[model samples]
Target: MMASFSGVLMGNSTAPRHWPAWTIYLRTMGLFCLLWYAMSWLTPNKILLPSPLDVASALRDRIDDGELVANATVSLTRLLVSVSIASLIAIPLGLAMGTSRLLEDLLEWPVELLRPIAGIAWIPLALFMFGIGNGLPIFIMIYTAFFPLLLGTAAGVRNVDRRLISAARTMGIPKGTLMRHVIFPAALPSIMTSARLAVAASWTAVVAAELVGAPSGLGYAIEYYRSMLDTPSVMAFIIVIGTLGFLCDAALRSLSAALMPWANAEEKR
Candidate 1:
């Protein structure tokens, strides 16, 4: 089965050529819509699971009124801020830990100990520390994004070919220069993978945080409408969140493909 799938992906003799990723995505979405419609038809209570058309209508109304855009903007802002901070802090520390055994020894235990804790688990402390505001959501997002990026970056750096590092050093290149030129490029694919994961984590954290403590975000909107038994509105907000997350990941993948041609080629293979 795996071989057949790979043959399909590679357009080999054993299987027909696979559809483009976007085409497959569209087909999957269409199937999901059909299933959703069928389920909505079968169910007696629209409140429990509203029809897709009803949800779409609710989404359209929100979009026309600018409420959806406003809430999405707030959520995206928090995601951006938290991810930016996490990247800044994690990248350099990850580099240091990867390069220096002493630094790794110093930080590894603490990082490992803390990494197991879920970002959602920090909600209470974040609320207490930052209060019920943007700060709380941002903190939660940062907490969610930080560890994946840190671990991914450090692993990437560590996995860089020893021969390449030795060759650079043997050529009398400065340590900083070697790191900037050799280590960074070699580790970029792993870092990019981590960044994508971090983005996903940031989205999840922001929504979870907003659901509990925020005043203006998609998660908050969903929670508010849910309380009122506004199932269509809740579904609309959820659809918005899922769409935004998908777009963000797609954007990251496109950026990675543009910036890291080698990585893209490897993936195609």
Candidate 2:
């Protein structure tokens, strides 16, 4: 038994490679479509779980009519703006807090207190404050994105080697130069990872924020269709949301690889 267990452990040491990404995606999605079709057929009410073909047809109609593009663009634009704002604030604040014990002490409590709260929980209050427009969704998404980015940056900064900083200082490097040339580069991978998380979190928040607060967006389209018992269209918008999020993450990964050539580009794998 011991020998067999040891052999199994040794055998598993090398990770098996998967097929090319496109093939993997198609295979997975094909299975998913088959499962969806089966469920749709089994369901008594077809409207509740529309067949894959029905959803595809609806999706095509939306695409042809340009509603899909308009709403997807709106949602994507909000995600970009909110994430940009969150990154601007969080990165600098995280760097400062991570480096300075005093500053970290001052801000740590507030961060801890608020980070536990879900972004969707703020929608009710925000809806009242922002009153049904772009501001509400943007505000919620920024809040959602902020904590992940801030935490990621601080962690990256903290993980940077003290040895490197000391070596740079011993060589008479300026404080600003040491930070720019040593700390930031070392922390770039972690920061990029956090940026992706921030983007995802904000994207999720935008949907919820828009459901109650905005006149336009993917969330609004989903809700509008749901109200009208248009499950196929709802599913279409959902598929669009998921595809956009995946594409956005892929773009970020490419950017990370380009920026940090020495690091493993597919670290998550």
Candidate 3:
């Protein structure tokens, strides 16, 4: 089992080499579409689960009308802004906490206490604090994205080799320079993984926030169509969400590969 796991991680020949990753992904999605179609056919109520064709038609209409594109733009903007702000704050704070025992000791308990709380759980409080506007959704997205990034950065820093740090200090390298040259690179893989996770979390939180308060966005569109019993439209929006999430993750992976080529090579191996 361990050998198989290690082989998978190392991209070794544990399985048939003929099936590439993209081929497998395509096959899986094809199977999913087939299943969806079959389910839609078998169901008596089309309103509950719209057929793929119905969803496609609705999606095309929304695109032509600019509704989906406009709302998706709003949601994407909010997601990007929130995640950027959270990353800005969390990365430095996490690095500081990981490097400083005093700081970690002081903040550890409070962070632990808050980490378990779901971002959606704060919807009521956010609504009360920020009222009905972009602020509510942005706040939720930030709350969702923050901790994963913070924890990932801290873990990355803590995992850095003690010998490297000592050697840098011996060479008279300044603390900031040591962290930048040695620590940040060493911890980048974890940080990137956390960033991908943060994007997913932020997307989910933004949707939920829109459902509750926002007048515009993909979530609001979904809710609007759902209330009107427009299952096809709702399904279309859901497909949009999944596609956007996949795109966001892919973009992050590309950025990670570009910034940390060595890490990317190691991962491929």
Q: Report RMSD (Å) for each prediction in the order shown.
A: 5.1, 5.2, 6.2
**Cα-based RMSD of candidate 3:** 6.2
* TM-score of every candidate relative to the true structure: 0.91, 0.90, 0.91
Candidate 2 structure quality by residue, lDDT tens digits, 74-123: 99999999999999999989888778889989988999999999999988
Q: In model 2, what is the error at residue 47, expressed in angstroms?
A: 1.4
**What digit string (tens of lDDT, one per residue) describes model 3 on residues 1-269?**
99887887888865545788899999998999999999999999999888999999999999999999999999999999999999999999999988999999998999999999999999999889998889999999998999999999999999999999999999999998999999988888889999999999999999999998799999999999999999999999999999999999999989998999998688689
**How many backbone overlaps does candidate 3 show?**
0
Collision pairs in model 2: none
In model 3, which runs have C-alpha deviations exceeding 4 angstroms?
A: 1-17
Model 3 CA lDDT for position 254? 92
In model 3, the Cα lDDT at residue 252 comes to: 97
In candidate 1, which residue ranges exceed 4 Å CA deviation? 1-23
- In terms of lDDT, the poorest run of 10 residues in model 1 is 9-18
What's the lDDT for all of these models?
0.93, 0.92, 0.93
Better model by lDDT: candidate 2 vs candidate 3: 3
Q: Write the per-residue lDDT of candidate 1 for residues 1-269, one digit (tens) a residue.
A: 99888777888885754789999999999999999999999999999999999999999999999999999999999998999999999988888888999999999899999999999999998888988888889888898999999999999999999999999999999999998999999999999999999999889888999999899999999999999999999999998899899999999999889989988788799
The lDDT of model 3 is 0.93
lDDT of 2 at 96: 81
